[model samples]
Target: MYLCSTMKKYVDVILPLPLNGTYTYAVPDDLSLSVEAGCRVVVPFGKKKYYTAIISNVHYCPPSEYEVKELFAVLDDSPVLLPLQYRFWQWLSGYYLCPLGDVYKAAMLRG
Candidate 1:
């Protein structure tokens, strides 16, 4: 038998776009159980197109800028990123002198 986890918190995510930084989203009551740092979520970016973004951090404070949007869906049952992975990406960005989005694009293109 299988069981689903419960969600009880909200999170603010940082998308790798030119936009400012961090968008807030509410965790579904039932799905929050598996949500955590490094989890990837499919979210509506602008008008069309959904992008897979890593959950940078989770918080309870309400967004102070724009209205928070609900997450379109969770993509993984567990977090996809680890601390080392994040650090590596950071290092790559610094060494390459490029935005993280460039690295993400390269990875996606290869796939």
Candidate 2:
């Protein structure tokens, strides 16, 4: 069982867009168990399309700038991202001076 805490868990997701940052989504109690760093999830972005995003970070710290959006669905039963892979993505993002989202799309894209 989860201990009671004032701070709630939040997830930072990487979208396929070329944007430089990740979006924060609040994890509801029902979906908390299933969400993890490195899994792909479906989230409603903006007013329209729902995009599949890579779960890059999971933490208790909620973002201060904007209200977090709720996740629409989880696409993976298990984490598709390995811890090492996650680390590499971070390094790649910094080294290449490109958004992690772009690297993620390249890595996940299958022909």
Candidates' C-alpha lDDT: 0.66, 0.85
lDDT of 1 by residue, 17-106 (tens): 534335667776666766788788877777787877777677555554565566778878877777687678667767988776565445
Task: Point out where model 2 deviates above 4 Å.
Answer: 1-7
TM-score of 2: 0.86
The Cα RMSD of model 1 versus the native structure comes to 7.3
> In candidate 2, what residue range of length 10 has the lowest lDDT sum?
1-10
lDDT of 2 by residue, 32-86 (tens): 8889888999998989889999888888777777767889888888899999998
TM-score of each: 0.71, 0.86
- The most accurate candidate by lDDT is 2
Which residue pairs overlap in candidate 1's backbone? 6-33, 7-32, 7-33
Pairing residues by index, what is the TM-score of model 1?
0.71
